[model samples]
Target: MSQRLVVGITGATGAAYGLRLLRRGRELGLETHLIVTPAGVLNVHHELGLDRKALEAETSFSHAPGDVGACVASGSFATAAMVVAPCSMKSLAAIAHGFGDNLLTRAADVTLKERRRLILMVRETPFNLAHLRNMTAATEMGAIVFPPLPAFYHRPQTIDELIAESIERVLELAGVAGAAPKAWTGL
Candidate 1:
């Protein structure tokens, strides 16, 4: 059986990546636990063109953002790993320092403390040294810190293509196969 993976949506801009990851994980026959923060709600509308409430109602499965009792919050739940797509600097800092105030941050902390794969798609640009330090701390603690940088070799012509490449890379790094886009061979 495929394993379960937790996908966290934060206040960062690329909310589409979280939605796409959930849909893809389900398609791959893997159960997914989705956590969308309160700020994640507003950011989704601003960035993804999808209404959070409506989509959550229509999707395969989900939990309220702030639900701390969700299964994904525990390490004993026994899943593959967790991915915080478009991970806000706030969330990253929280995870890096082992803060578990919210479900998203809590799950990330669980992933790290348990030494499981914790892929953080960190989203920030022109980051200050402090942001870099946070990312470094998370990495030192075994978090896969990935910034949302586009892959040009894919020659993505649309925003969706670019987003897909980034999410695929995150999934691949977490040891989930077949989620990545076809290799970029120059035409």
Candidate 2:
């Protein structure tokens, strides 16, 4: 698999997931390309106290959300996968309907069209019919709707641990070797 991973951060509440994904990708030696929506920057700042610059610094390269001409927006740009952490419902809808109004969704569309993995860490509660249907649509189109839900099998003590575990699982799904979370050996 290519070492290039494209990551998108939307306006969802869980900006930390995107941040941690970038950090982990770097540690795992993956070249991460990031695209943060305008609202995504707001959430990152509000939740993690980091500005757009700080968030962009975490990746190997950063592209503006509106940059449709970016390398990541092309199917020829060999990438291992594209993951949208904290994917907003709006973004999900856009991706599901093939609306490449911005680079982030365009990259995701390219990933799907290229038959590469596209994981969406959707963040929302009490899903409406539209959200569920959109998720279904995306799934049918080969996008994995992976919500950033925490797991408790490891008995995590801190929020960071939970996030780490989730990210590890995501990385494993993204085809990153040695990224599997701790296995359950049984009680």
Output the number of the lDDT-best candidate.
2
Off by over 4 Å in 2: none
Cα lDDT of model 2 overall? 0.94
Candidate 2 lDDT, tens digit per residue, 65-180?
A: 98899999999899988999989999999999999999999999999999999999999998999999999999999999999888887899999998999899899898987686
What does candidate 2 score on TM? 0.98
Please, what are the lDDT tens digits per residue for candidate 1 over residues 1-187?
A: 6777888889988888888788777677777877888898889888767777765753455778678898878888887889888799999889989889888888888888888999888888889998999999999999988887888876789988888888777777777866765676666
Listed in order, each prediction's TM-score against the native is 0.91, 0.98
Candidate 1 local distance difference test against the native: 0.82
lDDT of each: 0.82, 0.94
Model number with the top TM-score: 2
